[model samples]
Target: MIKFDKVTKRYPGGHEALRSVTFEIAKGELVYITGHSGAGKSTLLKLIAAIERPTTGTVLLNNQNIGTLRRAALPYIRRNFGMIFQDHKLLYDRSAFDNVALPLAIDGVAGREAGKRVRAALDKVGLLNREKAMPIALSGGEQQRLAIARAIVSRPAVLVADEPTGNLDSNYAHDIMALFRSFNEVGVTVLVATHDAGNAEGRLLHLDHGALTEGVPA
Candidate 1:
C-alpha cells in the first residue's frame, strides 16, 4: 500500500535525512521502523504522510504519487492514514470522547454518529468508562490509549505510530503493542517507529543515516 522509490530528503541546512530510500509495504502489513535518534524514521513517515516532500525520487500511497499531491489535496491524502505520537498531544480542556470525536467532526460526521464512533474507538482502546474524563485527569497510559483511540476513530486504512511507548512502563508499553496487534489483525496497516527493541515480533526495518537496511523477520 506504500512505496518509496529512490527517495531522498535534505533539510535546508544540507543535512540529508533520507538517502535514496526504497521500500514497499503491502496492504495490511505491520512493520517496525527501528533506528537511533536522527536516523530518519520520522522523516520517512512525514514523507509518506505528505508533511514533508521528498527532495528526490517518489513516495506513493495506494499507488498515488504523494510527492506530487496538490496542497489542497493534502488533507484528503492524510484522511486515509492515522498517526500516533509519543507526546499524546491531547487537548487538556476537552473530554476524551470529544478529543476522539474531533476528526470525525472535521469529516462532517453528525453529532449522533460521531458520538457512537468515538465511543466504539474508546472501547476498543479499553477507555470506554473514562470517556468523560479530561486528559490531565487520566494516567499516562490512559492518555496514550486515548490518543490511540483518537487516531483510529476515523477507521483509517493505515496507522503510523512514532515512539508510542517512549513514556510508558513495560506493562503499559506491552498493552499498547497488544492494542496495535489487535488493530492489525483486523486489517489496519501498522507501522511503528520505536527505539525500544524488547521482544517485538513484527517485521523490522532498520534505518541508519537515512538509508533503509533489509527487514528482519521475527
Candidate 2:
C-alpha cells in the first residue's frame, strides 16, 4: 500500500540519491530491492518509511502523501512501520529482551502484554532463551536476529529492512530470509534492500545509478 511517483531525493549538497524513481509495494507482498552500492536502494527504503522526504514528486502510503506530512503527523505514520537498519541497532548495555521491549515501552503498552509480545517475537527469531544476553556476547548472526526481534515485537503491518543480511554468512542469510518469508505469509508487507536478491520470493526491483533499471514496479 505504498506508491512512489517520479520521486527524486536530493541531499543538501545537491547529490541526487534517487532519480525519478517510481514503484509500488502492495500490502502483504515481499519485495526485494537489488542494486550495487550507491544505487539508491537505501534511499528508496528511507523514502518509503518517510525518514527522508522526496525533493520532487510524491510518496504515497495508503493514498496519503507521507513525504509532505507535517512534523506532528510523522510519528503516527511511522508507527505502522518496523525498520531494520544495516547495522543491528541494539543497546549493548541492555539485555536482548530490553532492546525488544523498548518500542513497547515507548508506546505505553502495559508490562504484562508487552512481555508476552517480546517473548513471542524473540521466539520467532529463535532467540527466546537469549533474552537476557547482552549484545556484545552474541554472535553477529544472533545480533542481527535480535535486531529483527526488536523490530517485529511491535507487530507493525509493514517491515522495511536495509541490508538486514549484510553481515551474515550464506546460511545465516538464508535463515534470515526465511524469517522474513514467514512474516510475509502472515500478511506483513516486507521490503528488503540487499546486494544478493538471489531467487528471492516476491517482486524484484533493481536500481542503477539511482534509477530503476529492471524489475516490475508493484
RMSD after Cα superposition, model 2: 1.2
Give me the runs in candidate 2 sitting further than 4 Å from their true place: 216-218
Candidate 2 lDDT by residue in tens digits, 1-218 = 99999999999999998989888878998999999989999999888887888999899999999766898898778778898998877899999999999989877886799999999999999999999899999999999999999889899999999999997999999999999999999999999999888768888899998999886454
Positional deviation of residue 89's Cα in model 2 after best superposition, in angstroms: 1.3
Flag clash pairs in model 2.
none
- Model 1 alpha-carbon drift over 4 Å, by segment: 216-218
lDDT tens per residue, model 1, 1-218: 89988999999999999999888899899999988878998898888777788999999988889878898898989988888876778989899989999889888897788889999999999999999999999999999999999999999999999899998999999989999999999999999998766688888889987888756222
Q: How accurate locally, in lDDT, is each candidate?
A: 0.89, 0.90
Candidate 1: 10-residue stretch with minimal lDDT: 209-218
